[model samples]
Target: MDRKDISEKYKWDLSFLYKDNQQWERDFERVKSLTNQIKQYKNKLGNDSETLLEVLNLQFTILRNIGNLYCFAKMKKDEDNNNSMYQGLTDRAEMLMTEVDMALSFIVPEILNISKDTMEDYLNLDQFSIYRHYLEQVMKKKPHILSASEESLLARTGEIANGPQNIYTMLNNADIKFPKVIDEEGNEVEITHGRFIPLMESKDRRVRKDTFKGLYDVYSQFKHTIASTLSTEVKKNVFYSRARKYNSSLEAALFQNDIPVKVYENLIETISSNLDPMHKYVSLRKEILGYEELHMYDLYTPIVEGIDLKIDYEEAKDTVVEALKPLGEDYINVVKKAFDSRWIDVYENKGKRSGAYSWGTYDSPPYILLNYHKTLDNMFTIAHEMGHSMHSYLSNKNQPYIYSGYSIFVAEVASTVNETLLTDYLLKNTDDIQIKKYILNHYLEQFRATVYRQTMFAEFEKIIHEKVEQGEPLTADNLSNIYKDLNIKYYGKDIFIDEEISVEWARIPHFYYNFYVYQYATGFSAAIALSQGIINGDKESRDAYIEFLSSGSSDYPINVLKKAGVDMTKKTPIEECVRLFNNSVDEMKNMMLTK
Candidate 1:
């Protein structure tokens, strides 16, 4: 469906951000003026607590306005990437953001120069109470904080450093094209990135195989270019890691959120030891589908038949509301506000960005974008994105602007918890054998994709970064070999590890995101624990989860999650998730046997 044909109520009301572009432009100019004003406070942070507070307030005000301006422009661009006007707006907004970062670059180093006793004295003042945690976080980075000039130089190079990711986004989203493939109906359809997954879900093995080959054929063609882009991104991570005096890129990435390196290592270690369940899942898929040899192309195809649930957008909203009622009345009311306040841009259109996300700034309502199709998967996606939106809403309402945005570490926890609740709700409420089997299958698949698959990705990321850190070359052949080997180990000997799956690394945009994909796996595990707590525990459990949502970046992400009852520092969550996966698989086996 085209965006224009979609009803107005389905579209997000961006006017809540600004009445018009003219208003946005006015804020744009105001931000530019404020950026210039920020220069006056340079090197004066230690003058007094009052001076520090004043500068901080000005910085916050400028950033708050900039957030609204950038959110509006980028969201406009995402609505239709083909729109050149919004494209330009997004570019300008990015540049302005860079300028602001450069302007405020000295804040950290200058603040760090203050003696710890002096910093504590400032924190004791009533005026600085709210920013106490913010300042403390800054202090934690004191060792990595460079000189003022060096910091400013690093900040100024931000745009240049983002060149690799920008190029990859254009290539993946805009430039590459897949060959036409014959569908199950014997009709030739041009393949696209957005259509690739749905094609993989086709029951017709021919369609799935054809789409897999067709999609990878395009990626393989651009192997050299993509490899170069990926290599540059890795080197960029290395550059920043060394520049900031971090032990490694992993350290640098995790340190920003104050997560212990062991957390990352523990996730990998626990998942590695628990690969038996994943292999069992692969065997189950092979047996149920009656595949002589299960291939990578066959992984996403549904194992059960007679359970093709198609849910429209309206039904998805209602189902999500029903599913999330365990979160409490206030939580449900916030979700209702999201539904009624036009906080979501639903449906896909020509040039609309693919995938789904929840985004917004402190000054505006949290917004979500989805290319929602009428399927059970799309319904779960609605619940997932709404989880993020509600987290943002609660955090923004309760915390200061600086603390409003949560870390990516805790970000996925909220979304995945919602998904877990939805799955549990569906399983408990449905009496039909087919529907129960389908929901159980979906749960298993979630573990496979989110936990097993992402853990494999995380391992691949670690291998490549370690190689780069050791001064090993990252050519196409080398990267593919590493990925292929990992794929073999994770999927086990029961499945055919297709050669095309090696080039799969070339297409994943997350590799460009330094040390980011690991969070999905960890977050899924954390969500499993949190969801269990909410379902099986008392009102205190539910209240703690809500408090975690509203806490935002006020505390370390690990601490926030601990308060919510998940101790990510240990391997317990990963073990629990694997246990859940095993139980679901066993249930599926029993259901299949009875049938």
Candidate 2:
């Protein structure tokens, strides 16, 4: 069905953000003017506590306004990417944002210029209470904060630094096209990034192989181009790491959220050691599917067939709300509000962007976009994105703007917790053996995708960045060879490592995301621990999880998870995830044997 055919009740009301484009224009201009005002306090941040507080307040106001402006334009453009007017608005908003960033670049250096004793005094002032955490975060960067001139220069390079990612997005989403392949039903279907997964899950091996090859065929055509773009992105990360005096790009990336480097290292060390569960799952797949060998294309096909668990959008909404009831009455109420109110764009339209994301500013309602296909996976996606929306809603309500936005390190925890809860609810409530098997497979796949797969990506990221740091050139062959070796190690000798999988790195947009994929592995592990606690109905655990959601950037991400009773610094969480994966595999093996 076309998006326009969807009811107004199902579509998100972006009008809630701005009554019209005119209002958005007004906000854009106001933000532009406010950027000029930021210069007024350029050198006066440490004049006194009052001056510091005022500057902080002004900076927050300007940023908050820009957030709303950018959110509106970007959301509109995402609604229909073909709309040139909205696209232009998004471009202008992005440019204005870079300008605002450059204008406020001095604020950090100026704050760092103050003596620690005086900074503490200012933080203790009643007027500065709200910004205490924010100020302390600035102080943490004291060692890395450069002179104002250099800071401004770095900020100005922001747009240019985004060039690689922008190019990849255009090439992947807008420019590239996949060929048509015959599906299991003998119908010819065109492949897309959206349809690629579903196609891989096809019962017909012919379909899966065709879609996989067809998809990669296009990616292979431009491997060199994509390789160059990824290389540039890595080089950009290397540049900032050196400039900030960090030991490596990984350290610099993790430092932004104050995440310890050991967290990344621990995830790799632990997952690499725990590849037994992964190998076992692979063997189980090979045994159940009656395949002598498993290929990359065979990884996604269901082991137990004949169980159709497709869910429509309405059912998905109800399932999510019901599954999240363990969160408490107030949380359920907000989920209900999201369903009833126009807080989500519920269907795909022509030119609408692919995939799903929860996005909004402090000033606007938390919004979600989904090209929801009435499948079990899409149901989990609804639950996942709503987790993010609710986290934002609670944080924005509980804290001021400065502390409202959570770091990406902790962001995945909330979403994964929701998914975990949904899985548990499905398994407990269903009596049918087939249904149980399907849900169990889903849970196992989540671990494989989030923990094992992402860790592999993290290791790949680490290797590439280290190579670049050591002044090695990143050619297509060099990148592909490194990725192919990691694939062999992670998946083990049980499965065939197709040569086509070598260029798979060329297609993952996350390679350009700068040490970001590791968080998925860590966050998934943390969510497993948190979800287990929440499901136990322990008020203390529930309250702590809620508090973690509300905490946002008020504390370091590692410390925040620790407060929620999950010590990410320790190896316990990843070990717990590994144990869970093993347990699930055992259960699946038993179920299949009995059947």
Candidate 3:
């Protein structure tokens, strides 16, 4: 399992980024020199359009180089964590980046200080077109930008602001431990967050119930303490929002990407109005398991068991290519290039990174690092990451360096679209009823977890933050009650909402993320709608989707999605997604009943 033992093709060829370490060293030195030189423009940003444009150009160059250096060194370290050389390089790169950040701290604040008419005049310049959006974003934050002393004071309070999340992390990861439970084999297994979900999927009902109760029972014991942590977290958000002059914590959180509060409202309102499908899915789970009443713990177990498909790397590649044919030949050929060329590090090796991500510089190939094992989930991971890499590849090909990176708001859309297409292709191609049934169930789970579940989390966050904004206290009992009510509303009457489930919010780390869970639902909803149009072979829709992928941050994230076939500002995408979920439930119900 050592990295040295892996075949050359199975590993990433980082030479695409740099021919050798010497090239990387040369670039590192170049960045250092540029960092030292960039300070010359620190006070001259408001001098004129020419100087401002020049400074912007130089700034991006330094950033691009630093990005390459950090990405390369970190990826090398990821390939083998025990490699000391790359570790040193990564440290050095990180330090240099810090220095560069310090050196360039004046860029944005000074840009904001410029008069709006002057900034507009600069944006109208021919050479400033590429940096137009970048400058506009700076101007957009002008109202929120504070005085230097005030900003410094707020910056100093960052650690205090982050205390809640840090405390929650230590508690969840290190402090609290779940009691030992009897696993499926009658062996005593200590329950932990890492093993909770897989244990809940155990075929033995006793194991599922024990793990579920065991995990939540520990959370229940810490309910009051965690409620305080979450309350303080909410208070911290409210403080920052009020300090920054935003109307609410939710608005402040969404404002970074220029997302309006209406988008958040649309997500909650649309999904709430369309909960019948989610309820039906839950009801069908009770019927499928033949249970008098399905407990919350029973949800993770496979509805159609005995259909574990073992796919190899080769088969997964072929299947991914076939599934993605709807996107166009160009996209397919690039994925093929990723496979044939060394654009992917495809397997697990000793000390390699655990999960998969697509990373590269603007100049480097859109490289993927995957710890791929040949399970169905792993196959889907390939398609999912391929979606991200392709998005990067297309954007890097199409846009300038300044505008080449897209927002997190639309990032999940590409990956999930790939997943949706793959699921559709598999269902259509497979005649085996068992495999068909499994895929259908998998589709239903995707909607349940990504769309419905995340929307519920988003709604909870909104409610808690709203209460804090309105000066209401968040007691342990009230928090638990709010969570339990939402659980009942989301899962419906067929499943029992256990008392222990009320404390579930005590353990969720996302609650401290300040309104971050809603993007998952919105992005998933948009992907389903876009993927459905592409699957129907609508040429205009397919091309627009491709164009959306190629568009990085050239426009606002919402406008970027709007340019694509789906509009997140309206309720259409979420409704379209729920419709698909309903049809899939019907198909899956018929399949499960017939067999």
Candidate 4:
């Protein structure tokens, strides 16, 4: 209603976790003292069973405490970047990380000192039953566990190994600036990363062209440095994988959650086999937009004419809850609590972080940060993040400390399931042909971006990391050309492939994450199958899904997903998602003809 409310209202309340700075300071000191106490267990862990359990439990308690404190401070700083108190708290947390690292450095080696037979014998002793979960995890890494001195040395290298990514973040987030574009109205518009989206979505083709060139022009200037940083990141993955005795970087990365290599390969092969449907969807876009030739920038503009659903914050929340009813009373109730209990930040405030993320600690409620405009995209984001929060809540309620962190493989399933349910609900609820077409087109676009586009990224990531692992140099031109080739495979035959899109890889932050984007494709596939079952009103299906969410990391990620009735080991779920994409493309084309 008012400017202050519009800007400030976008943030969520964090006061429930810590009332004020004085209390937060007290918690910080408490954690620091605990860190000191933890060192008492360094050389003393192997003395007896009771001593080891007490030490491990104390460390877990301290960690969860630090997690809550750090997350709260970081969330506050992200909400309003200019807040000095929040800034100080974030800085202090980073410092405490080193202290925490030093305190726990001896535990892994000490655990490794216990013989396999002795560990099994100790687990059978009733007095140490509480630490069974902790022992199980440490023992799995026994082959890869290094000596205490080697482990400390590797940990110390974190400052140097992490330097390149820190530079990339600084350049992208703090230092880089984009040139302004001259609008058709003859006014100059300065381009920011946030403004780049609205500019590319401009109805005027010239404005879109200018915005694309203007943003990349700045990126081109720093291309070499960015390329080097990316190269180092890939090499770092290889180094760790080899040191840990994994077969490849992909194997080592997936090993973090104990996921099988089959899941990753199945995603790549299945999605690669289904690229035609996405190409067909792009062809439909070109026809509906009536573009004589559609360029990369034309992809974001709406294809359906005279259709507007400018949903504000409150409207978005209600619609999200209503659309998710198929998930049952308990699911809907938690969503309602998110609204009533201030679990979300609904609008953007000055100096806040860009984009959106779902964050929470084991000790506190899940919270979300969003810079909402009145777009349909924002509504989908609410559903997306609530999916994560509700998943965390269920997992924390059901699992132990060692099993609380769920894998990204299953994390995507929960979020995408929410999106698909909302899409199906909206299409069935609306009779307006234009709105229906708009929503359907939106769904098709997601399938393209998440499934097809991300698979291309996954392939590119694999190729580059392999090149680095094989001792190939990764120059700017070499990286660009490989990226350009992948674009050709996905969209070259359907849409015009601009040379500029090749550099698009350098700008993506996910590239730094090392074999991470493939899950977006697999997650969507699993969600498609899971949501269909829930929407069909099967009580067993609904119960199975809730159970999957509650299972967390107690079992293998693939096993957890299979219990929910979606198997990533096979290719059927991905094929079903591709079929869904193809069906939507047909619907869009048919609607265009009728119009």
Could you arrange the candidates by lDDT from highest to lowest? Answer: 1, 2, 3, 4
lDDT for predicted candidate 2 compared with the true structure: 0.90
| lDDT (10s digit) by residue, model 4, range 1-595 | 2225663434466877788888888999999999999888777777877777888888888888888788988887776665678778876776686568767878888988987787788899997776786678788887777888777676666556766665686577556778889876778987765556656756678998999988887888888989999988998989988877888899888887777888788878887787787788778778777877878877877787887668988888999999999888988988898888888887655566667778888777788877676778778988999898889988888887667878887888888989998998999998888899889877887888889988889899889988988899899899999988888888746688777887887788888887989998998999889888789999899899999989878877888988888888888988888888888888788888873
- Across residues 1-595, which tens digit of lDDT does each residue of candidate 1 receive? 5678989998999999999999999999999999999899998989988889988999999889988998999899888877889989988998999999999998889999999999998999998988999998898898899999999999988888889987887777667878999888888988876677778888899999999999998899999899999999999999999999999999999999999999999999999999998999899899999989999999988888976677989998999999999999999998999999899999887777778899999988899998887877889999999999999999999998999999999889999999999998898897898888888888888999999999999999888888999999899999889999999999998899999999999989889888999999999999988888787746888999999999989989999998888899999988988998888888888898664
- Comparing 2 and 4 on TM-score, the stronger one: 2
List the candidates' TM-scores in order.
0.98, 0.98, 0.85, 0.93
Report every candidate's CA lDDT.
Answer: 0.90, 0.90, 0.86, 0.81
Query: Which candidate ranks first by lDDT, i.e. highest?
Result: 1
Name the weakest run of 10 consecutive residues (lDDT summed) in model 3.
147-156
Clashes of 1: 0
Off by over 4 Å in 2: 1-3
Question: CA shift at 537, candidate 2, in angstroms?
Answer: 2.1
Stretch of 10 with least lDDT, candidate 4: 1-10
Candidate 4: misplaced stretches above 4 Å? Answer: 1-9, 80-88, 126-130, 180-190
Candidate 2 lDDT over 1-595, as tens digits, reads 4567888987889888899998888888888888998788888887888888788888989989988988999898888777889879988988888899899999999988899899887777788788887877887888888999999999999888989987887788767888999999889888876788888888899999999899988888999999999999999999999998988899999999998899899999999999999999988988899988789999998888898667888888888888999999999999999889899997877667778899999988899998887678889999999999999999999988888999999989999999999998999998999889989998899999999999999999999999999999999999989999999998888899888899999888888889989998999999999988799988888999999999988888888998898899999999989999999999999998774
TM-score of 4: 0.93
lDDT of 4: 0.81
Model 1: lDDT of residue 210: 92
- Write down the TM-score for model 1: 0.98
Which ranges of candidate 3 are over 4 A from the true structure? 1-33, 69-103, 148-199, 210-236, 340-356, 367-374, 467-481, 499-514
